[model samples]
Every structure is written in C-alpha cells, then in structure tokens.
Target: TLVKTKGKLSFQEPKTKGSIRTIKVPDLAIQTLKAHKLKQKEIKLAASSAYKDHDLVVANWTGSMIDPADINADFKIACKFANVPQIRFHDLRHTHATLLLQLGENPKVVSERLGHADVSITLNTYSHVLPTMQEDLAQNFNVAMQNIKKKSL
Candidate 1:
C-alpha cells in the first residue's frame, strides 16, 4: 500500500496480515499486463538515465510513481470515453465481491480473494446475495431428490 505522510509518499504494509495475499488473475488480464510491461520496457529504454524504475506495474512514462489524483483523472477520462457511468475506482472492488457472491461462489473463497480478516466479514457484507443462493440450493436439492427417485424406480 502507498501512504502519504506529511507531504511525503512511501510504501507501507497492509493494514492487516490478511490483506497480504496473492490473487488469481484472468488470462486476459495477464496478457494485458504482459503487453503493458513490454510497453513500459520500451519507455524505460527510451528514458534511459531519466527513468526512476520504481518497478511498479503501473507508472509514469519516466517510470516514477503516478500520483493518485492523476490516476483518478485518467480513470474519469476512460469512463467518459467508454460511455460508462462515473464511479470511484474503489467501487470496482465492491462490484467484484458482490458479483462473485451473487454468482454463488463460496464465501470463504471470496473472503480469501478479498483478503477479508474472516469469512464472516464476507458473509455480512454480502448478506443481500444469500437469499438467492438459498433459493438455488433448494431447487438443486429438489432436482437431486427427483433423480434419485427415478433411479430407484
């Protein structure tokens, strides 16, 4: 995580141990990141001595950290160009969690992916999705029982 203290920027540990985790990325995302890395490499070659080389996945053309405000501004422009509704970048995290829960993904897995301190936090945060999951479970149970009855017959 990045911390801004008294007019200085620095990297810091996550707030909780749980927050330090590896996440699975989709193949498409991996490919995109690889392409971005190649582009960054070219930029580094061009910048030579001028490049700061903080080794960030995302950085300025000169390989320095991009300010958060600059990121937000770019995000706003991207949203506009994409014809998407304006939303804070952080909202993407909530959307990802909610979508997974709604799709009936295991709460524990989702919690781990989100680096939540506990599964209960994922359950509580996504309680609104549970009712649909329960309905699906009941339907699946009924189907299983029907199949068993047919096999017995």
Candidate 2:
C-alpha cells in the first residue's frame, strides 16, 4: 500500500493527513509472500476456468476480496494452531512496533517503514514503547552529569 511495485499498487495520497511512508519487509514475511505467490499462481492455473480472475495478493477461493470477517476467523484459527496469545490482528502491528522500539531501532526508520507521514506520527502511535527506554536515557544522563561534575572539580 505504500511502495508501488511496478506501479501496480500506488498510494497517491497518504491514508491520513500524515500518512506517507515506506517500510522494509522482514525476511520471513517476504519468504512467506513468495511461497504464497507460487501457490496462488498454481491455483490460478488449475482453476482458470472455474473462477473469476483477480490478481490480489491474497484472495478467496473465488478470487474475490476475502471478507474481513473471514480473515479474522482464519487468523484466530491460525493463532490457536500456533498456540499464540490472544492478541487481536491489530495487536500484531503493535507488537511489531514495540519490539522494534525496544531493540533501540531509530524511530525515523521504523516510522517511515510503517508509512507514517512523519516520525512524530510513528512515535505517537507507539508511544507506549518509549517508556521502556527511560531507564537507558536516565543512566546516560547520570553518567553525563557525573562527567561534568568531575571536570568542574
């Protein structure tokens, strides 16, 4: 939705007033997408005459927009199979942001990838992740203060 691959998917305007963004896909998701693409191609060939044609990244058996409800149902089933915690689909996005922030990633980088119009948008959306970094900030401040005091002495 952010990067237009071959101009196939273009975002002429931001989703919101502050929504221009680009993001890197993790290796796992990329690989999974590749696999899905291959499978989709196969399915498309096999059922070319049986279904309507659409080139969506993901789709239903009939090559149509998968209903939002169906997606949630499938997500829940997959989560149950994986023994994952009871997090909503939106929670996955939060988890991704939280992990990146906790890992000390640059907010600018993360925010851009999340397709936020600006760093502040990304920061605001994931502000909860910043609290965990307070300890690190405080420790650095203490060290800097001690250095200044020693120099003055």
Candidate 3:
C-alpha cells in the first residue's frame, strides 16, 4: 500500500467511514518493526539486480505479489508446528477483540478496531465475558450500599 500518513505513519484503510481510526502500537511492535525494516533494506539491496518494488510489507523474495493462498498455507503449517490448536487466521481478529473486552476496554474502542457496524456488535459477541465483569461490579455495588446504610445510622 502507499504510505498515506496522517502525521507519522500510515495504516491499512478502515473498511468503512465509521471504522477509520488510529491505534497506538505497543513498544515491542515498534522495536520489531525497526529491526525488520533494517533487515528488509539489506535484503532489497542484495536482490537489487532482480528485485522489483511491490510496496507490500511482506512479499515474495523477487519483490512480486505474494499469493494469498500460499501465505495462508504457510501460516497454517507454522501454526501446526508451533503446537497451536487449529484456528483460522481470521480467528485472531476475534481473539484480539475478546481480549480487549476482558481487559475492560471501552466497547466503542474495541468495535472500531474490529470495524464492526456498531458497538452493539462488540457487546453481543462478548456478552459472556461481560457477565463476569458484572459479577465483579456487583461486589462494588454491595460495598456502596453498605456505606450508605452506615451513613444513615
């Protein structure tokens, strides 16, 4: 993709107008990208005689468009080798959304990242986790009630 930056870096376009957003990268991801960029530069220079600029973050060694199917296949094999249980690559998206909800992220924030039609989608998908959060809140509610009762006496 073209480097369509707003200020410092560009990102994949949101699927819809409602979906457009900026996400902060973790420190580890930033450092990893720096190392990867340096290595990519070396690789490109070495293959300069045959390389073509494809402008993708990851591509075939000859700088051509990497087949999506081949990448998926490779990913599957790597997942299996790493002893990860079977899960679709798409599942990672769902996993991320669920993790965010478990961490008590605002539903609106999680919804935007997943490019959901709305926050309701994020809530519905994670209602099971929400119930546990409600249980924790109930304890706080009880404490508040006790405090109010003591004040009245």
TM-score of each: 0.85, 0.71, 0.71
Per TM-score, the best of the predicted structures is 1
Summarize candidate 2's per-residue lDDT along 24-88 as a digit string, tens digits. Answer: 68899999999998888788778887757667786866666665556678888889999987667
Number of clashing pairs per prediction, in order? 0, 3, 0
CA lDDT of each prediction against the hidden true structure: 0.89, 0.76, 0.76
Evaluation by lDDT, superior candidate among 1 and 2: 1
lDDT of 1 by residue, 13-95 (tens): 88998888899988999999999999999999999999999999979988877777778888888999999998777778888
Top model by lDDT, which number?
A: 1
Clash-forming residue pairs, model 3: none
Predicted structure 3, TM vs. truth: 0.71
Error of 3 at 140 (Å): 5.7
Model 3, range 1-153, lDDT digits (tens) per residue?
223344333446556776566778689989998887777778789998788876756766766665555667887888999999767666777888888887878899888877788889889888888887888679879999999999999
Q: Which residue runs does candidate 2 get wrong by more than 4 Å?
A: 1-14, 17-21, 137-153
Q: When superposed on Cα atoms, how far off is each prediction in RMSD?
A: 2.0, 6.6, 6.9
Worst 10 residues of 3 by lDDT: 1-10
Badly placed stretches (over 4 Å) of model 1 are: none
- Indicate the worst ten consecutive residues by lDDT in candidate 1: 63-72
> Which residue pairs collide in model 1, if any?
none
